[model samples]
Target: MQLSEQCVLITGGARGLGHHLSLAFAREGAQVIINYHRSAQAAQALAAQLGPRQAIALQADVTDPAQVQAMLATAAGHFGRPLTTVVNNALAAFSFNGDARPKADAIGWDAFQSQFEGSVRGALNTVQAALPAMRAQRFGRVINIGTNLFQNPVVPYHDYTAAKAALLSLTRTLAGDLGPDGITVNMLSGGLLRSTDASAATPEAVFDYIAANTPLRSVTTPAEFADAALFFASPWARAVTGQNLVVDGGLVRD
Candidate 1:
């Protein structure tokens, strides 16, 4: 019950990692606001299951500043409390098939820009939109979902990895700026989550390689990563900010 009476907003909360995080937050007694771009049915279904008093869903494309603002307004109106935590977990619908991988020389500006728009710009929009309320309440936790691939780079997800790295940079800078307002900003990076839709196309060999190489000799699950997120939002981490926690079974020790 570390998050009791807290309000949290999670982008892309309809499915996959986001979906699990939303449910985890609700179980901790948080009033959860889940944001979905295209998974309207999934969002509604999740909200219903979590119970109306603890969970609500909003539709917004995080890449658009206007949409983000509207979504925040809607959440505030419905919950009667400004968001205490914001999770920037949305990503563009890009397949990461091996053959589809773009080499540095082959990647066009559009390809790189699209990833940045969804990951970096989306985080910025959420941070900016929630700052006023956070400052007023003197408490905030901004957790950006990152990727351990940015550190190891064993597999070159050029555009996606770069975008996540940019988000990490933003998280640190925001932590410095918002520290005085009692806000903590942190990033949680995980390596090759076991059961997320994002990893559906990842080869079995790749999974086996990670499992064998990681310190724990296994892959991390979405629930485990979500628990790390919850810790950042908890009072235990009040003094912990501008940091990145790698929940990758100690695979890439940075």
Candidate 2:
């Protein structure tokens, strides 16, 4: 098992893409810690199925540094020491609704700041809370979830795209800063994933168009996206850091 005896913490793991990532890590023999803010029932059910020893779900608002610290402490207690991987998969409340597509003039500072708090602040809190343990073990993997839209800018989800761009910057800087400690930071950006709760509001015609235009002539599923994330967390990617791996069926060429 590539991740045997390793401990991984995934935020927003109660459902959608995060749920699949948690399962993928657990299947690779990792002791998974899932953090949820409002989906307690779903998180507990997932943990129960994975077995108490292999999976544990805790509640925490990643935007709150105090809550994030407490969640990390609880995870350490449940899974022993030396947190090996941290996946900052949490998203802001603004991302849930489909109405977030506001023109540049319509979008205000509050909207941008809210998204930043959820994407950037959440990752910072998780990294800060887990860095000490990683440094002690001299190994760590920090994978931030990002979007390919920022590169293509087809839909222009201004606030959301801007936030992910900032996260990419953080990923590179953190990789440089933490490299000496054997910690790697990277970003995984995927085109609109199919069959996720977040994409429920997206029009069927739009999805079909993307599928038709993509090189693979198919849509990317949450499970497929999880595979890319697993690579970043695995030993094979030891030399990979501060990079963005876009898994979008080669939709947008940089």
Candidate 3:
């Protein structure tokens, strides 16, 4: 399906990478539902910028199935169409400062669980809630945001990397089960992004180091990574599912 024909829901669409995802999808003529747990101000401002007809902001904690279901219902009602595409981009509270992060020996299970709740459970809630509509229409797109750390582990962000790895596994399995239903699931992973709220704490030297290592000789921006997400939602990627397309400028080849 063309992106313009899809009613897209982007979780955590208010700030950071999600902000760019919302803009990119709207720019492609997709009806965007901006989901946010907190960032209400940013979310509302962004929806206003995108315009009410093209986009709307809804609040939901993606790990909670009830909230997710309600948000989806409201979105469907407001847009007069069920969501045809979902971008799982919400992240748990996290900072990208390697020095500040707990080492393997010092980190606790709570950290891993928090990330898991945000990454895995959150995706599960959204996908499960939207399944009926997706199945009914015989067309759906699940584009999960991932990280290249599973392959490169540059800073060894144990909790975050492990959670994203689980999310990737879920993406592939969902693709296999939903492919016959005309639903496609794929993951788009990127390395340390140039700058995002979560990555703002990253040391400048780390960004320079990544840029110097990548073949593109530049750190990927949220906008650049978000643009790749459109391919999965578009007809161009109908036959491509259960794949992890790394967007880290050749930093890691899988």
User: Which pairs of residues collide in model 1?
Assistant: none
lDDT for 239 in candidate 2 is 94
Specify the poorest-scoring 10-residue window by lDDT in model 3. 148-157
lDDT of 1 by residue, 1-254 (tens): 15987999999998999998998899889999999999999999999999878889899999999999999999888888788889999988766455568887788888789999999999999999999999898999999999888779877688888899999999999999999999999999988888788888888888888899988999898898888899999989989999999999999987
TM-score of 2: 0.96
- Cα lDDT of all candidates, in order? 0.90, 0.89, 0.95
Q: Which tens-of-lDDT digit does each residue in 28-113 have in candidate 3?
A: 99999999999999999999999988999999999999999999999989999888999999999999999999998899999999
Q: Locate the minimum summed-lDDT window of 10 residues in model 1.
A: 93-102
* Model 2 global lDDT (CA atoms, 0 to 1): 0.89
* Residue-level lDDT for 46 in candidate 1: 98
Q: In model 3, which runs have C-alpha deviations exceeding 4 angstroms? A: none
Model 1 segments beyond 4 Å from truth? none
Best by TM-score, which number? 3
Candidate 2 lDDT tens digits, 1-254:
16876899999998989999999999988999989999999999999999989999999999898998899899888877658899999888644334557787787889889889999999999999998899988899999999998878878588888999999999999999999999999999998889787887788887898899999999899999988898988889999999999988899779
Backbone collisions counted per model: 0, 0, 0
> What order do you get sorting by TM-score, best first?
3, 1, 2
RMSD of each: 1.2, 1.5, 0.6
